[model samples]
Target chain A: GAGVSQTPSNKVTEKGKYVELRCDPISGHTALYWYRQSLGQGPEFLIYFQGTGAADDSGLPNDRFFAVRPEGSVSTLKIQRTERGDSAVYLCASSLIGTSGQETQYFGPGTRLLVL
Target chain B: AQSVTQLDSQVPVFEEAPVELRCNYSSSVSVYLFWYVQYPNQGLQLLLKYLSGSTLVKSINGFEAEFNKSQTSFHLRKPSVHISDTAEYFCAVKSRVGGKLQFGAGTQVVVTP
Candidate 1:
């Protein structure tokens, strides 16, 4: 009965460095999503995974933002050449797949990345 | 693309006072509405949702939200707030067929005595 969990609650890195944020979805969840939350703003969608393959990556800001869920369970968000602008909290969520796609998603305590 | 707007950034209320948080969303078609609450240093937790059928939904923790199609709003309310209710509340919307969500700038509710 564990919920979604993210690694490295806080990460500080220099600009132009690469970072990888990991997410472990709830057991038996096949749908995963990634979002970014900036100060004084709402969370913005980044990508979605359905059964191991990337279903929607349009929300990803650029090629530098990539995510993978190789086995349809755990996921990792990879950021290349991280910029100061990329400083924000990365959130991960998971939900059960449904015919209507209205299932409730459980969120993880985001990972706050600071690019100095 | 779906979008959500939370009008109030913060709401301060005395303990045992009624409180309301306003939320409005924009979408071309019918969508799913949800309310999530986040405590300090915690992830968001589901408060309530309005998917279909009844436009009114309530959470176990004495919180409720009414979905209004005409206004495209889903405002959260509670008859009497407690100190434990202090947290950031978010409004989210997504297409009925898509799982991606669009969240609003959260509303911070501070319950004071």
Candidate 2:
């Protein structure tokens, strides 16, 4: 079966530009998550969605970051006015129909974004 | 609030040598623990997890972790590491019922031939 996958493996944009990262979760998985990983650092949580609703989004750093999963299968993370600080690898993960703390999340290859 | 700490930023070991990655966490309530590995230019893969039952948990790749509640630690260990074991390891924790995870800075494991 296909695992979680992301589009545009690499994205390079200038500061103040807008960018969107896409994620396709595994089939039948109801939970989706987004995380960001900087150099020499572990992944930091960004947002989480259960079904069509966002179950938790406190991890989003600021108002410039937003994500949505309208159809409940694919998700998109939109960043407005990108900054150099946003340069990092964006990861997406998905899990079966279970509570967050107890479920195992499978990750995607990630999209490396560079904001100059 | 919950947070995880990986004490060792990097661990270098020769092939066939033993290795240990220390992890500690702080949380106001009981939580779930997880270990994830990431090769260069790749995504994270689940190594093991400690939800309940026994304090010691093992993965299929001859790696094991012992969850010590009293110490607030979940250290991962491998008796003998292979060259293929070189990767970045992350420690994560979340509240028993929460959806968001708090991750440590991560540890880089380098296996030498």
Candidate 3:
């Protein structure tokens, strides 16, 4: 009965460095999603996984933002050449694939990434 | 594409007072509405949702929201708020097919004694 969990509750890194944020979804969830929340702003969509494959990734800001879910259970969000503009809280959520896609999503505590 | 608009950016209310946070959404197709709350230093938690069957949905904590299809609005309300209710509340919407969530800027609710 564990909820979604993320690693490195806070991360501080220099500009141009690469960072990888990890997320572990619920036990039997088949759907995973990633979002980014900037200061004073709402969370924006990044990518989504519908199993081991990437289903919708249009929300990814640029080529530097990439995510993967190899075993359909755990996911990793990779950011290359982190910039000061990339500083924000990265959120992960998972849910069961509902028949009407109306399932409630459970969110993780999130990892706050600070680029200096 | 879907978008959510929270009319109030911040609201200050006294404990035991009634509170209401208005939320309006725009979408081409049918969507599901939700209310999420975030306490300081905590992650987002699902407060309530209106998917189907009921125009009014209530959470266990005495918060309730009514879905108005004609107005494209889902506003959250509480008869009497507690100091513990002070937090940031967000309004989000997603397509019925369920791909991603589009969130509003959020409303900060401050409850004082």
Candidate 4:
């Protein structure tokens, strides 16, 4: 009955620092996704995971951004050398099915990251 | 590449008035369309989606969207809205069956009583 959950609702870090955002998907969900949303803008795709491996990571902006879902249930988005432009809300989503794309994605509360 | 466009950046309306949010998308391949709503300081929630079959799709909360391939648009409409309906609405498109979704800028609906 629990929905997707994220940790550290808000995070503030200095530029050039690193941060990790965690996401816990709903039980029995195999597909997980991460998105970034700037102020007053819609969310943009970041990465996707189907089980243990990333099905498609083309959405990732650069090599500094990476994600891991070792157990296939929880995922962590890693940002290296954070910049002011990286300041945004990081959202996580999960669905019962993923490969088919028909399943509806359930979103998390999101973690607001601020780089100063 | 797939992209979405929300025609209106903001839509203000009085309570009990009809409202419509326009959306258009561009993609070389067939795509799935969806509308999501986000309340202040909250995450996005599914409002409605157009996958296949009937072109018209409705949500449980008095919201509906129609898929138009010719126009490459999927507009959201609510005949009569309540003040509580104020929020940001987004139009998104998925080019592949299980691929990344491209989202529009979003429309902020401000409902006045």
* lDDT agreement with native, every candidate: 0.94, 0.94, 0.95, 0.92
What TM-score, to 2 decimals, does candidate 3 have? 0.98
Interface RMSD of each: 0.8, 1.6, 0.8, 1.4
Per DockQ, the best of the predicted structures is 1
TM-score of each: 0.98, 0.98, 0.98, 0.97
Q: Is candidate 3 or candidate 4 better by TM-score?
A: 3
Off by over 4 Å in 4: none
Model 1 lDDT per residue over B1-113, tens place: 78899999999999999999999999987799999999987899999999888889999989999999999899999999999999999999989878799899999999999
A1-116 in candidate 3: lDDT tens per residue? 89999998999999999999999999999999999999988889999899999889999999999999999999999999999999999999999876888888899999999999
- Model 2's DockQ score: 0.77
Better of 3 and 4 by lDDT: 3
In model 2 chain A, the worst 10-residue window by lDDT is: A96-105
Question: 2 or 3: which has the higher lDDT?
Answer: 3
Query: By the DockQ metric, which is better: model 3 or model 4?
Result: 3
C-alpha lDDT of residue B89 in model 1: 95
Every model's DockQ: 0.88, 0.77, 0.86, 0.74
Better candidate by TM-score, 1 or 2? 1
State which candidate, 1 or 4, has the greater TM-score: 1
Count of clashes, each model: 0, 0, 0, 0
Model 3 spans with C-alpha error above 4 angstroms: none
Tens-digit per-residue lDDT, A1-116, candidate 2: 99999988999999999999999999999999999999888889999999999999988999999999999999999999999999999999999867446988899999999999
B1-113, model 3: which lDDT tens digit per residue?
Answer: 88999999999999999999999999999999999999999999999998899799999999999999999999999999999999999999999886899999999999999
